[model samples]
Target chain A: MEGETIVKERRILVAVDESEESMYALSWCLNDLLSLHTNTNTTVLLLYVKPPPPAYSSLDATEYIFAGDAIASMEKYSRDLAHSVMSRAEEVYRDFHPRVKVEKKVGSGDAKEVICVAVEKLGADILVMGSHDYGFFKRALLGSVSDYCTKHVKCPLVVVKRPKNV
Target chain B: MEGETIVKERRILVAVDESEESMYALSWCLNDLLSLHTNTNTTVLLLYVKPPPPAYSSLDATEYIFAGDAIASMEKYSRDLAHSVMSRAEEVYRDFHPRVKVEKKVGSGDAKEVICVAVEKLGADILVMGSHDYGFFKRALLGSVSDYCTKHVKCPLVVVKRPKNV
Candidate 1:
């Protein structure tokens, strides 16, 4: 960063699960991007992915988490979800930044598809995501979404580590 | 993974060089690990990071690239610079790993420290490497031996997307 100046204008598309995991990923991006920006025209999109609920045949006991209303009027729900996450994240961002313009959005579909769509649709310069550290058994049994995203996305993607517990 | 049973008995480490923009980090890991197995106990470590080069303000750019004997004690001369990267990675690892372990390391120093420490001292599962992708502004940067291996370690790491055709 010696003689380099920060470029603050790129659109940043981030996947937010509203989970601790997402907070970790978002913080890293916010912090790193903040360090590099010259306030070029940056907008942060916090995209939340809600995987469709599993059917009765599905082995997951947690299917209920995404049931009924979770999938109903997904577009409307996603909009609200995005708004909620961004509203909350905005408060945190203000604490560190005063001039940054941030926005949020919600989408429905497979995590990978949602992300891919967001990048193309939003013209994002970067995608920030968090990886859930799964146990050997769990990972072997179920494939990793984060790993898949790391493999598929075209833009500069970062699967950031969890932030330290301050 | 349909009917296929997952059996990761050994551990391998792959490092990804962080300094350079990386495009084919994982493919590189797969190529190397697919070939070797340490008694069926092998798992690949797709590493991609190394520490920064030690201050050689006294040494010229030529001296730094050709760091003579100080690098001999390490692995291949091609990957000599990676030796000092661990200083920047802020690595945090668990104490015990059960089966074939796939780990990612990031180092801020030179490339060798991350690879050597993970392979020779830390007992990495294997190593994989690849050159970074080149954009119009950045030319072939990750291909430097020291930079590529810095992202990988010993064992059987694979390499992919070594070419910049992309």
Candidate 2:
């Protein structure tokens, strides 16, 4: 390392979900991108965004118990899904680069906003995401997370699109 | 090298210009991003887009000679600029990573369209660009090459923004 340039540690944030696309992005970042930076210290941050809980309106006396149970169950499901996504992401890079540092964060809000804020908060050097490849009409109506982040994130962004036939 | 993944060659198209912002991006890609991919075969493609020659309409006899001279000078300038830009890019990466394979390409047209078409024609696995960081008003009016490429490029894209203070 005598002649090598050693800069401060760099953080790369990978936004993940249950979709295979996100997982593929994480794997690609590790196997294809992160492996080459032999001199720089890099930490991979994994972010899982849970959709905000639905609003529960005023419930009649008879409906109160059921509503409470439903809310609790939904919360539990969200927690479980977040855990599963993190676990899968961990399995990916850990297998590829055993020594790379990993961090986990779960945000509850609109993914586009959450991801943008997370990048700023974490001071990420780069943000990596997997494109959902939503068609023109669907993307227009629902909005794409990667597309939205591109306009808003302060740091560099890499949107990985899995090949259609792969 | 045993047990390492040796995938097909990867093509990374990096759009460059005379701007320091773009040069920073090329350095970042070589120093931080491409350095980590220890096993994969990667080629760095440097693309330079020259503004299309101005449309010269029919001119009166006296104007024709001067116009021809001006056109020749402008073409020479464009050619010289392209050469210098490519030479600078090669110097940066060669100093950083001597063995990294590099290819140069020059295209004439609107930057956005030429970049998008180049990615598709080259079958680039990834497209890397430097953001101009145009203010909201300017970006809306002039349009950004990186922004347009994000919408149109078929493969993954990375937009690197150089910090203002740096």
CA lDDT, every model vs. true structure: 0.53, 0.85
Question: Residue by residue across B1-166, what tens digits does model 1's lDDT show?
Answer: 6997664354545565544333244432332222222234444454555334344457777886686545553434325544333322223222123333444444445555556666675564334444343443444444344323422332322333343354
Q: What is the lDDT of residue A107 in candidate 2?
A: 99
C-alpha lDDT (0 to 100) for residue B126 of candidate 2? 86
Q: Count the backbone clashes (under 3 Å) in each candidate.
A: 63, 6
Best by TM-score: 2
Stretch of 10 with least lDDT, candidate 2 chain A:
A31-40
Which RMSD does model 2 reach against the true structure? 3.9
Worst 10 residues of 1 chain A by lDDT: A32-41
TM-score of chain B of each: 0.40, 0.91
